[model samples]
Target: TYTTLDIQNLLAGGAGNPIGHLATPAASRAPGEDEILGRVTLKYEPTDRLTMTLKASYDRNSVNNSSWNYVAFRCGLGSGISQLSGYACDNDKFVTHQNNMPADIAANFPYAKKDGQLYNRYESYAINGNVNYELDNITISSVTNFNRNNNRWTCACDFQSSNNATWATENSTWRSFSQEVRALTSFDAPINLMVGALYQKTRRNFGQWVAFAGLRNSAASPENQFVATSKTSFTKGETTALFGQVTWKIVPTVELAGGVRYTHETKDSFFTQPYNNPGVTGIFRDQNDPDGLGVVNANQTFNNWSPEVTLTWKPSRELLVYGAFKTAYKSGGFSNGGINSKFSTNPLADLTFDPERARGFEAGIKSTLADNQLRLNLTAFTYKYLDLQVDFFNSPIFAFQTLTADAKTRGIEAEFEYAPRAVAGLNVHGSLNYTKATYTKFPLAPCYAGQTPAQGCAAISAIDSRQNLNGAPLSVAPRWTGNFGVAYDTDLSSTLKLGTNVDVRYSGSYLASGFNNPLSRQSKYATLDAGVRVGAWDDNWVIALIGKNLTNRLYVSGVVDGPSTGSGTGTAAGIPADQLGFANLPRTVQIQLTKRF
Candidate 1:
């Protein structure tokens, strides 16, 4: 194993971008993932005018994942902070003089370690059925759907890589069912009418156990290796909606339509954490602890009336134009996620936020030219969002929380397709997108670990904090994105065909954090992919070879501050917290086969 300083120096002066170049083997490198998926569909017709269809699917996944350890150094400016709480520094600017080790190394380089892997299992089952009956002037239809999901995963909180041994696990389950009925008119008049009504209900539950680190490894002493928390939450939701639309055919080539939907929704939420145990974990803790004193029960109701209007005109058989305006809202819900403590004020009032709403407009044009060999489409859109749900880092709690922010987004998208008549086997397509997404008002955002007073860090309370991120861009909302692809197809035989394609995808730089963590910013990146396939004319069987990220670009996808010391506070905030990021998958090539009946 390489020493701490050795790896530190190699990680670009302790910045640690692109750590894959290091030759050191990982401390732990085993991850397991298994999945099963199946789907089936059936169709029946009793008469030409009546038809029915049913579809069902099931998916199950089991994953055993782990996190590797990383060394940390105490910062020179971090004079009064504790050793393991919300503190980690290894960058050159923050490392203290390493008088505790050989060669006057600045900062202590404690070797990182991990206890075990994280276990997660998920399963989902779904069923859908539809029936349509056609009459003289109107058609009637009904649709029904049901879904169930079960999941359990280890929580990725209390992350510390330097001797901060902790682990947490959560169990969750969800189920929902919905039914909708609709009627449509097909009269010979210049106008058509359609209407539908829907009803749905959902239920979900989650429970978690947090094992905080203690001085001893034994569970014999009730307080040692204590289970910091044993909490559970339950949520139930119901929705009823009625929607209708009317279309007016102004002419053979023009049409105008309007639609409106009214929805009533309700949420029943409950959360609790037991205080009946001596805070012990595993075999020593009581799962049936009677602690009604710590429970929080909450309920919420919402009503929304969404409306939209659209106009479409076809100037010719080869060209079309369309424009639309719409307003919609998302339902509000309680935030009984994790554990809630009575000491933390009213849990419902503090965590629950209003429903997000949006009003937007869009316009588009589509054209086909060059004797139908060339096609182009362009669209532009803008939306004003209020009370957008935002998950942000909280330095005091060392965990992220859900809040609300006001935001806006505007964008333009263009796509083109070309199929040269001269090149009978070749086709080309590409798209370009530009977006601007920013928070208009977010005064209560959390600051990065070490933001100073001058940078807008302040105390909401003795144990809470806030920072102004009034104009920050939305997380993961890149300003620009584009893709280009080319494909060729040829007949190998009367019964067989060959196809090949190549594509390149690109994205502009963007911050990966809602709070705008400097270390979590991602620069622009692009990837190339290619595939080749051979298949029968009927598509009864096929074989293909595909390669992804052929350029092997190791771009960061997302970031989370963890391993133990989550978001740093106090003296630890003076230095940027130890950042943890996830990278895109490496380059790989695989062969796939498919057969259909």
Candidate 2:
């Protein structure tokens, strides 16, 4: 017996007349988001060993945005806001001099229109316990868990006419508590063992006015026709972790598993001061405790290790096979608190950077066919990396180097299932995958153009180590993906009941570079989904008709760099390319109802 209840609401909309992205100027300033979700689960067992479970959850999300917009290269022209209206001198950093309009409309178009309001709240509570013990040859088992989580976020923004006008108003509160302890052992000979350990911790707080700003750009510019002012920043960090695992059965079809884990981490940041422009000097200093950053001591510590191994084979029992080796690590960070960096008086050395690595290998197969109505599984993998911490554009770069431009990934995964229970209740499932990532050696950073006789004021550096990135592919990793499903149940004779389902997914073409800059590409798309169900009496109803991107294909996920290098390359066009995507959710229809006690 099973009981469940769920309620979901989501609304997203976009209606013409809003376009801006000549390299991500907040992408026309977001506006549309409303979400709500509720769920419940319960299970019970009367005797023989004891089992009970209960879970509850709720979430609410809201957003109506517009933080900053005014393209055309903040007013210099490289085609953004799609050039807003008119200004094209054959593009690519135009040059034909004066009275040509496209210089941010002669400098007074100083735009900053971002209206925002946000609310987020989530709640969850869970309890689960299980026990079974019998000692004859040795059989003992126990499982226990408890969970509680609560989160909150509030926001307000407006940055129109400079007193900085509130732009970011904030509040954040989070609480999490969890516990898990388990033990189990059973042996008859042929070598057998099981052992486990796990622990966790979480704490967070941002009381109120945590810190906020919607969008900004203004180091004060209006010369050679380039005016600027756009800013949007928000910060919060708090975390903790603990983990462990093991299993072995040396013989009886060979089964072995091993695991190791160790982790400890902490981070803190709070900032709000420096709305610059009256007399700028050294990182725009103007403070009175917008979370204080001058001598307010901050701390960071991290240690991480994860190791895993598994090998299993069983010639029979429906044919099974497995192989795996794993090691993963990601930790090391700090930066993003603002203020201090006219070139640093040292705000912790303007925030530090380092930490990123992964090593993995896997192989797999599981099968059952024809005789039992078909079922299959397959897997293949490869990963080796190091120090690859990249976030470029939001500022953070270690520059893709496994050692000297090393990052090779391989993948192949497949799954299939078909059930023909004489057609009484039909079912079919499917999955397919193929992944590829490349970059054998990438390093070549150099810039600085025009007016060079003694090279003193124009400079850009980091020249050569080796580069070969085969021109884009591996920005969200999607070299081809697939999924399919269909299910049916017929029985409208007693108590009236009928159920139906359908699902399909396909993805190919992915490159949303976080900055390796290979002509900036993000193109590839495919999607399909559907569902229907109905039940009477005890009450369970669902009338669903859902469709998304039923082939409304138009791609561009993200791209960057169009300026900001030495800022003058025959006209400057080396570090500016912007396009961010996943913008698909064009069709929708829904109806659902469920109840049980």
> Could you say which candidate leads in lDDT?
1
lDDT of 2 by residue, 24-71 (tens): 122222334566766676767666455565656565554433222111
What local lDDT does model 2 show for residue 574? 28
Error of 2 at 46 (Å): 68
- Best TM-score among the predictions, by candidate number: 1
- Give the alpha-carbon lDDT of every model: 0.67, 0.44
Give the clash count for each candidate: 9, 25
Q: In model 2, which regions exceed 4 Å deviation?
A: 1-249, 265-279, 286-292, 302-311, 314-320, 323-329, 336-363, 366-475, 479-507, 511-521, 524-558, 561-597
TM-score of each candidate structure, all chains considered together: 0.82, 0.26
Tens digits of per-residue lDDT, candidate 1, 1-597, equal 111222233334322222121111222332356889999999999999999999999999876533322223232234534334444444212121110111111011111112333546789999999999999999999999999999876532433333233445667889999999999999999999999999999999876655433312233234322334566788899999999999999998999999999999999888766522242222122334333335567788899999999999998989999999988798788765643533333445644557989989999999998999999999999998988987654434332356889899999999999999898889999999999999999987876665556556676777665688888898889999999999999889999999999999999988866777766666788999999999998889999999999987755556555433333343324544445555555577889999998
